[model samples]
Target: MLLNNLNNDQGFRNFYMNKRGPIINHLCFDDDVILFSSGNRKSLKRIMRTLKTYEDVSGQLVNKHKSSVILHDKACARRIDRAKRITTMKQECFPINYLGCPLYLGRKRISTFSVTVQKILNKIRGWFFKFLSVGGKSVLIKHVLQAMPSHLLAVMQPPKTVFEIIENAFNRFLWSGSDGNKKLHWSSWDNLSYPINDGGANFRKLADISKAFTTKHWWKLRTKRYLWSLFLNTKYCSRIHPVTNKWRNGQSHNWKAMCSIKVLVENNLGWIIEKGEVAFWYDNWTDLGPLYKFLDPDSKPSKLRITDAYQNGHWNWPACGYVVSDFIKAHIERMQVVLSDKPDLPIWKITSSGKFNIESAWNFLRNSRHESNIVNALCHKAVPFKMSFMAWRVFHRKIPSNDIIISWFKLLASPNCTCCRVSQPENIDHIFFQSYVASSA
Candidate 1:
């Protein structure tokens, strides 16, 4: 009903996309109602009148005192005052939290997203991790600490320092004892973040997770026609191509940060050009990258689409005069080009399923190029968590081992091997194997 009245009002104008399609001015999900309009006296009056009408017809009164007006444009101070006077509601400032997310007119600041960090810290500080076993603590780290930032990361990209802070807190929680005394970290965070199959603790890396999520969001923007996607496309990415466009620093920090993962996405993003509509020079349809890059410099760039290689939904070999090399010929022949009537499908290359999901993205980001089997015993499922952790320490040469405890961390007083009652240096080798008592055992 409010929409109807607002639509009829000649003076009212809602935000439009590309100056072509009309965007809805009001959005109501459950009890949360958000009304948006141009910052003008006429538009504001129309909105207020529509709300008043809705109240009268529905027998529900809007609490004007609770509802505050926020103006995006500071230049419209007079108009803002008029709206405030007409509605008898207070005018709120920008950078205020709306439904747990910070809303502001300009670039995002680290300070704006500090709430998420504080929330995570508060949760960690209150937890009784002392009673939990290593396995239980690992579960908490994965499900609780890692999950805390997901909701925020889904919508916006926090600063790099934010992730560093988060990871530091995680490190303390994992390594510190129940009494809060610091213990030696078994492995570097990078090594511990690898997959279980690859001999890691399977812990997620903060920076990588953030990048994967942001990249996944970018994928959605390309494939999905959401209102936010449409708005962003019409506003920011209208002139820029997805693969080649560089994110400018002056743009919205949220978008700039999101687009920062474009290179990673491009490296892994593949397409099934069923209709052959892909751009021959730019699109990643072939495994060898853009065909233009492989071509001789003397060869003039052709305006040929991939469709030119086909005639009546069948591969036309004679028409592909551009294919000069025997390798190109074999590559094309090997390609199962069943030209379907359906549009092309974009896929994530790292995943076996070929769909872009957060889990797959995270896995791609955390995957190590070098595979090692030496740590497999340490990460084996049969091993207890504390033993596995200890094994990790031994693998990384981080065990306290008397001398290290005495010298490096300065927690212990003596360097003698206590188990063997010998003056020999109590290094890892001596404590575990070389000592008299250890050898006897």
Candidate 2:
């Protein structure tokens, strides 16, 4: 309603988008208002007046101090000063932190994402992570440490170095502890990244989480009528199909990040082939996977459709030039295609219901290669965290027994069993099983 009044005002003008696009003067969510302007002094005054009027009508105060008027870098000094005076808000530059996310132009830099790293550090600096056991650290990593940077990861693809820094912090906190003392890590971070059911500490990689977020955004863009989706579609792919559109080199950081996960999306995105609009080689309508994958990686893909391969209601692979093995060919040959009036729609292949969900997307994108293991039982609520850590240490042969310490430290000491009269090496096996005292106990 405020925007409508602003548009009607003779002094107001919108930011120049493409010639054929939505008339987006400004957009707001909650108290966050992202205003677009043509940088006219009269226009800025009009916008403030409109805001003031809206506040009067809706009983919502428009705090000028909380708002900002950001102008293009090339704008003249006079325009900048005029904007500052008109809005009475802070004058800031690009690469600024807006609502906890960086709004930057061109390539995103490390400095642009420094706030997230700082936030993560601030969240953990007060806690004594070194005093915590493996179980305690595991819980903190999942529920606290990892969750800190998730908001930033979902929106921005920070540099590889940033991810490494955050990961290094996680490694130090979990293995070496917060005291900064070096310690032997009993398990590799990769192993620790798996879920408790899969015998890991559940310290997931933020990189994977970022990919899941990108995939979620892609799914929304393709399937939903969201505001951001509409804006992005208008700006980048107004005419072309969202899935098939080839990304130009000049695009934003998030767009490139979204493009980087195309293969992951294709693997799980199925088609509801109705009008047969899905590409024959590019799409996965046949359920055997993208036919393009079966072809040579360097082969120039020929443009075709699902309807092209069918003649008189029968599947023919050779007719489509998709030279797959007889097994794959036979699989597609037996499959039936039912043509309908509706267009092809994308579906999440992970579930039968055809709805895209974050959990399914995360599981698929994370590429869980885990199997059931002892960690499941060890992670029970009744078991103590330290005891669980001890059991894991014993299982991995990392316990500081006499034989282990002597052999591991490259120093010779008494190798005989200390628990019994039986003169046997005090190894993990003997200490736990072979010794008479151990067996009797």
Candidate 3:
């Protein structure tokens, strides 16, 4: 088959070369065809007839529907109707589907062509998904659902209860996992981790409590009668009030805090001791002895004092200052410090006089080598900011490439790409040149 294809390609090339004088370029890939020529309409018609004859002899009929003929000029190539041929010479416009994209003829700019191409491609994709089965339909639905507005999604309310939500999510999973007509095995609700029988009593109790809480009578009783209302409200509280011995305050006091700690010890011992391996720390405290033993072996009175000092505040002290942009600035600062100290470094140097413009300093360092050591150092430090200005200077300084201007306009127009939601400094390679799945726009 490979030999046959090679011979066929050679034969076609030779035939076009020998017989067609006006044929400038021709390309064929398997059954697909693209032919270029610098001939008048009469000559092109003659060539087409000859090709048809050859196809008839070779038992490969030409798909005129898929074939096209355009005059050799940028305007003609741009104006040619790829989908439907122009029957009249006066017709200035035609429609074509180039590379699975519908394009209107007579578009003067390449940018417009690209936009039209993308639109048609998306339309084709929509059509393809529409023709698919229930499972495929569900996938498209999921995609659409993800793209929907958050407010609209909330209002839709597909599932109200936890059980209903779980059931709906499982149904979606089942549909996605199997193809059409293939059955999915679902165990009885009894076989679930929390069986319906066990959950029923809890659910009913919760429903009754919720009903009582939201009732007009409960609200009136709490508001109309002051002392009785305070007492009734006190029963709902989890914290013991300072003035009243009853649990009456909204905030969690020492007693409630201890209760929470007890619950954590009872419920999360496996997580703390085995998974986190905090048994060393757990052993020191009697109530939470196992957890303390796993967490810290030497957790005596002295170590507890240090731990209390560190854990006094709600948030961790070390992590409090570590914002996303701080990481980038820290990396840049570290690279600058390292490069300034190195006397013989090719891509960096500290002037006898200190100048503090970041861009200028970067340029001076970049001028010393093809590979920017400062930028490389920043990369080593795991900084997310790309050396975009340097890349722009290399690619767009000499030749005024509109691609670069378009890129700049795009970046300036929006900090984030429309498709992938990644923020700038995004390059053309990251946006369009790479795989579409990975591309930002």
Best candidate per TM-score, number?
A: 1
- After superposition of all CA atoms, the RMSD between model 1 and the true structure is 4.3
Residue range 1-441, candidate 3, lDDT tens digits: 222232234223322332312223445657765554434444344445566567777887766654555442455443454312332222223444444433343322334234333443353344442435443443443344222222212111111242233333333332333332333323222222121222110011111222222222222322244543444334432242211223324532322332322322222222111121112122221232232223234433111211232233222324322232454334423432211222221111133332223333222222121334543443332322223222322332322234454554563343344455444433555453553565434
TM-score of 1: 0.82
lDDT of 2 at 331: 78
Residues 340-412, candidate 1: write the lDDT tens digits: 7788888888888888888888776665745457678666878887788677677767776776666766674
Evaluated at residue 122, the lDDT of candidate 1 is 89
Overall lDDT per candidate, in order of appearance: 0.74, 0.75, 0.32
> What is the overall TM-score of model 3 with all chains considered together?
0.20
Clashing pairs in 2: none
List runs of model 1 lying over 4 Å from the truth. Answer: 1-9, 20-24, 27-30, 52-66, 105-107, 128-133, 181-191, 197-199, 275-280, 291-341, 367-372, 406-414, 421-423, 436-441
| TM-score, every prediction | 0.82, 0.79, 0.20
